[model samples]
Target chain A: MAGMNMISAAQRFHAYANPARFMALSARLLMPLAALTALLTGAGLWFALAASPPDYQQGETVRIMYVHVPSAWLAMMGYGVMAVASAVALIFRHPLADVCAKSAAPIGAAFTFLALLTGSLWGAPMWGTWWEWGDARLVSMLVLFFLYLGYMALWATIEEPVRAARAAAVLALVGSINLPVIRYSVVWWNTLHQPASVFRMDGPTIAPSMLLPLGLMGAGFTLLFVTLLLVRMRAEILRRRVRNLRLAQAGGAGEV
Target chain B: MTRAFFALLARDLRLAVRLGGGGGMAVFFFLVVISLLPFGIGPDRELLAKVAPGMLWVALLLAALLTLDRLFQADYEDGSLDLLTMGLLPLELIVVAKALGHWLTTGLPLVVAAPLLGLMLNLPGEAYPPLILAMLAGTPALSFLGAIGAALTVGVRRGGLLASLLVMPFYVPVLIFGVGAADAATGGFAGEAGRQSLLLLGAVALASLVLGPLGGAAALRANLR
Candidate 1:
């Protein structure tokens, strides 16, 4: 409580603004994080495929739940991370935050696409349709996917990194507002998709036996995202260094 | 300030008109895109009429997107953008004036030409008024929103495509509501549809009016630097 009051999230954020410090911290945590990610994902897949019982209705096909749900969760989570990182880049002018936000785009896009693909595969058997436009969650997820693509495309198309970051930051912030609307559009409008069952006011509807695997899969996916994020951040740091080195060499040549 | 705004607006309009093909290209592009749709879906008049309003709206949106690059590119290249950015007026007002110019050149001409295209596509009579109304209320939002993209990609080598890519996603809501309103009208629910969609379109235009210029100004500054 004292720590929370003493140092706000913004101030705490400033502490890691320095790229060298961030790189060092990421490097230190990388090994353990990678191990945890591998271990959890391996175990989660085992439980998901072998341990969790088939749904009474969905049968074996419901196994897609483990992958689909986690990917969907991460797609939204990735956007949340992007929005915060973009805000950090804009307000605090943190260099690492820009790198964090920029590097996360393609990864988030991949997650979104995976969620859509997996959801479609699941939908084929359960809903007896490959796609349903009336499902608000599904439509919103598609929009989210496009947003991810646009964000990445904005970055790739721009020649200047700083300008790209700024433009993409504005986009990221704007797109973040849609996340909740997407989540609730189903409830607000009568859609074909079911409402929240796992994270609702009344508590989770799934039995514990099924819940265990879902929870594990969720944890595994979260760990996997963090691991991938750290790797991407490190790669960006190196790329920035290379760019700086090239600029320095050019400067030296001009001086000569 | 008002004089400067009008002067700038008039100048841009004149320049666009003088360009010979600026206004016509958007209309032509709209026609071609809509024309291609029937071939792709097969020439069933009933289907075409059913989908015509949405198709026209989508084509207009894309046409507007395709031409958005011209919103600032010519001025940026010829140093007029710099003058406008550095001039005494605030950037937001200049943006509004520029957007007005854009609407006059691209959007207004599209609206004028849409009814003709509607006839070609056999759009139902009931759909025509709402289509024009939606376009009138909505295309300004496109110009305003597209201005930000135009400003962002103003000086890029192949900015036209990039500008489209950057702006089209932002254009989605406008496309949705514009087409939705047209669909409602054609489905005999025009009176029941009220002005909610139009209001939302206006809200988008208003929001873009505020943010568009700041973005444009920032992008302009970046290009100049």
Candidate 2:
């Protein structure tokens, strides 16, 4: 039954919350994840730039959409992942949750930065301005970027890992709740940005030609997030191991 | 439980007033910030009047930030927060009490002082009532929401700046509706233009009232662990 399969899936998730298990699993996943990411990136880029037709109105500047839209989606997606990790860390005391959340911050920030940069570049040609405050999506994205910065800053400011993890988890949850409010506020206020075209109530308004490139680029970016997260989480685990080893060595010398 | 809450509230109020320069520092900062705006923006009375709602709200937010670190940091530093956490009353009540104390001390004064500052900015006479009403309805939300940031950063040394960075984004909704309400009041649109924004501001305040204490308490407990 489907319910039995769901239970097993939950079991697998809980099993991997163990750091040693997570380390071994992620090591296995990393190679395939990286290979898939590279393959997707190459194919996605080729299709987006070479195969997909340019926008009738936007012309070649629309190529930026291949990068911009996907990065923006990943930026939001990355925060969602961090928020879930925080929730898991708080509720289950999962050993790997904090590491997962912490490792994702810089990657999220980078994607957010890329989204903004590509957005500006796109806007400069299309809208005849480098930036537009009247755009709700852009403004909301900016706020999201600031949230990432604040989250990272909190982690840096606190010296104790346990204390920092808890505080950051609480913050991440609060930010997640506030995200909708921020988005709503921007939308309620005046915005010059075009309304949603891809994700709509009935169906996507975008043409299939544009949609194909967008979909491929989205998948590629998501794979990259997975590859980067695994690598960063592994590095974090090793750093903790080194710190623990150093402490044990110091304790041994003191015993003499 | 109610008595315990009130007692904690009173204790925080007294401490903020007595030791922390009588909660006047925030109002003073608010005053100074308003005074400096004319110099920076070049003293155009019309422009000042036009932007007064936003300027006042932004200054109020910054002034509120000046006092936020004091919300939990003092108790945190003196080991009292740990004791409070272990006390009979729940940590959530303590958070509510502290945020209420912050509102009473800092937020109320800023609301009280806004009309006077509004005059210097040449804010239209019709705008004053809504502006005051908006601030009164909205500021408790700021205090409560800010307490969460204060609690999160309480374990860090000299975390005042980080607290502001963490807390200010949360203040955006309040700022938007607060400014909107003031604008509606001044824009002279007929049939309750200002009323809608004020009502929305109240809704946001209510949501924050429920969420802030819970979130702040959770952060405090986490830090204590």
Choose the strongest candidate by lDDT.
Answer: 2
Q: Write the per-residue lDDT of candidate 1 for residues A1-256, one digit (tens) a residue.
A: 8656545665766675677888898999999998998888888889999988887667787788788888888998899899999998888667788899988887887888788788767766654445433345554676687678668767765767789899999999988987677567534543333334312111236667877788888998899898899899999889879988998898888865
Candidate 2: Cα lDDT at A213? 77
Q: How far off is model 1, as Cα RMSD?
A: 14.9
Query: Which pairs of residues collide in model 2?
Result: none
State in Å the error of residue A41, model 2: 1.2
After superposition, candidate 2 runs with Cα above 4 Å error = A1-16, A191-204, B1-225
lDDT for A210 (candidate 1): 73
Model 1 regions more than 4 Å off: A1-17, A182-204, B1-225
CAPRI grade of model 1? incorrect
lDDT of model 2 at position B189: 59
Model 2 per-residue lDDT tens digits across residues A128-195: 44544445676578778878877886786676778989999999999999999978966665333433
CA displacement after TM-score superposition, residue A11 of candidate 1 (Å): 9.1
> Per-residue lDDT of B135-196 in model 1, one digit per residue for the tens?
88888888888888888888899999998899888888888778777778776465566366
